[model samples]
Target chain A: MPLVYAGVCSHAPGITGRKHLADPGIRDAFYAAFDDMRADLEASGAETVIVIAAEHFANFFMNNMPSFAIGMADFYDGPIEDSDWLGIDKFRAPGNRELSHRLISEIMQTVDVAYAEEWLLDHGIAVPLHFLTPRFDLPVIPVNINCQGPPLTPLHRAWTLGEALRRAADAVPERLAIIGTGGISHWPATPDSGKINVDWDLDFMDRWCRNDRDALLNYDDLTVYADAGQGGFEIRTFLAVSAAAGGAQGTVHFCEPIPIFAVSCTIASYDLGLLDI
Target chain B: MSLYYVQKFLYELNRSADLQAAYVSDRRSVLDGYTLSDEEIGALVDPDIGLLYVLGVNGQILMHFAAFHQIEWHDYLQRMRDGVDEHGPVREGVYAMTGRVGTGECG
Candidate 1:
């Protein structure tokens, strides 16, 4: 089956862990957007969800980090954070090792991705799963783009990975959904945690919705750090989804900076029906 | 000033419940494994979040360490600001304070 769904959303721990701290009005609106994303994913008849996330130092550390990695296990357990601290209970999400192996093999044809048999979920994956796959029932294939550490994955390379993922998804018989989760223009996990660049975010989303490859890859990391804070490196995740969308236009479902949540709190996806796939 | 090891220690501790238990039981022994400066050792032992931040530990790792100590979110941010106020600027890493401190929506 061709890739059935492709979208992106925010995955800050504050989105779930600090929900009570945000204004209930904007908070509920943001959550309703998540609900719409879930509805769209379900409506796609997706059998597996491939979550491309800019993970923190959860699984990969500086010791031996891969620019890109995919999970290959029958099951994965997480919030790796203290359940109370993250406000998400501990649960094991199903993984399909067979599906992962095939996908990794296919992705390796184009992108040199490391395959991990063991992975502990952090908020990057956990927060999205809390909404997208609420019951933890769907088989999840986790992909990580090393956006945290310096000497990060280059922007264009992330696009290649996404293209590779789309190829693998289409080659497979089972329907697959791709959801990329990360912040756009916010400083997270620092004293400047709640800072967001609304203009920068809106401009970037404009390029994203237009699926303009040149504009999306035009950003350099130093400028990103200055304009979007260090967290802006996570645009790699979004860029990959755009690459996967294969020229399909997108719609921004929700986007507003909730300082306490530490991001613009966005939810957006491509119109895959526009493609002939 | 072994910021790498300091962050590495926290990275391991944050993900491992067993190491967390061991650290709580005998914090000193946990220090034996990593090559760290006395100041780094003291900061980790004290778990002085602000000092660690000024010492250049990445907030992604440091935040979890703070949470492990039951530090609240706002308190965690304040501790980092206080660290910068007392100890000059962050020594290393990409997470240095950008002087855009009070410009956030939360302010």
Candidate 2:
């Protein structure tokens, strides 16, 4: 199956339903974009979706956590955020055991990847899952990354892993789609820290969709981008997704800063180049 | 000092409620029982301990129990190893709807 790839957010900053949290204009735009991406995934003839994202407190604690988790549950649940932005109780998706097992073995042969038989789908996974396939009807393969810890893998490592995933998908006789979620640019801490580095963020996003792995990995001061503000350098997920997309270029959907919580509520979609790939 | 050292020292101090009282009665005995080296003891009481003691009682105790006085790190690792042997390693893949949280959040 041709791989349909995308970058989606579960909590689009202001969209989360706290009266103090919603930005009607951006929220509208996010929904519209979500619908468009869902249509795109459908058009790509995707049979299974491999979602690469992170876990909040759901599957990780202050203690032990793996750098990666492959979903093995029969179904994965989406989290509800109390507020309307994400209050929708739950979304469920079927698990693809055959493809999931194949991908895990392929990944482990090259790196120390972990297999989580029991992992609760956190907002990181749920938010995007809810947006793309709202009914939770799709069969999904969720990959968890340790985006918030020490001994944090390098950008190159994330790229290599994504490349491995690309290979894994190519090997799957069944059709597959890939979704990479988390962060456009919002610090989440210290309200004012959410300023979008428009120039840098856009630059990274541009290069990311093109699968410019070497360029991204070789960037002289990635930590500065990661530490420069609250965006937390999670833009790397996009880079990872781009690698899976076989380096397709992108077109912007929504790009603007929603400063209510001091985070830039930016959302964009890249052309997955199904025909070209 | 490393974050680990500072956290360990503060943790030990909080584990014993009578630490201050015990220190006053006989510092050597308290130090001896924990097998703390002279350097560790010196570092613990140093006025410049900085943020080591700022973790409050509970934080201190937890850190101490984790690092020095309680279960060994190898034991926990062993448990993980044993679990993997018994239940198989945590498998990774696309899951159906399963959002386990709170007490059973992490495996």
What are the fnat scores of the candidates, in the order listed? 0.52, 0.00
Clash pairs, model 1 backbone: none
Give, for candidate 1 chain A, the lowest lDDT window spanning 10 residues.
A268-277
Candidate 2 residue-wise lDDT, A1-277, digit = tens: 4455555443432344232444677756767877787887788777778887755435553356676668866676555222233345655678877678887887777666777766556556666666677778888888876664444556676776777787777776777777777665543322122355556656666666556767767652245335334244455566667766666676666655555433444456567665445
User: Second chain TM-score per prediction?
Assistant: 0.88, 0.31
Alpha carbon lDDT of each predicted model: 0.91, 0.54
In candidate 1, residue B67 scores what lDDT? 89
Model 1: TM-score for chain B: 0.88
Model 2 spans with C-alpha error above 4 angstroms = A6-14, A80-85, A191-194, A219-222, A225-230, A274-277, B1-107
lDDT of 1 by residue, B5-78 (tens): 99899999987789999999999789899999999999999988888988888888899999889999999988
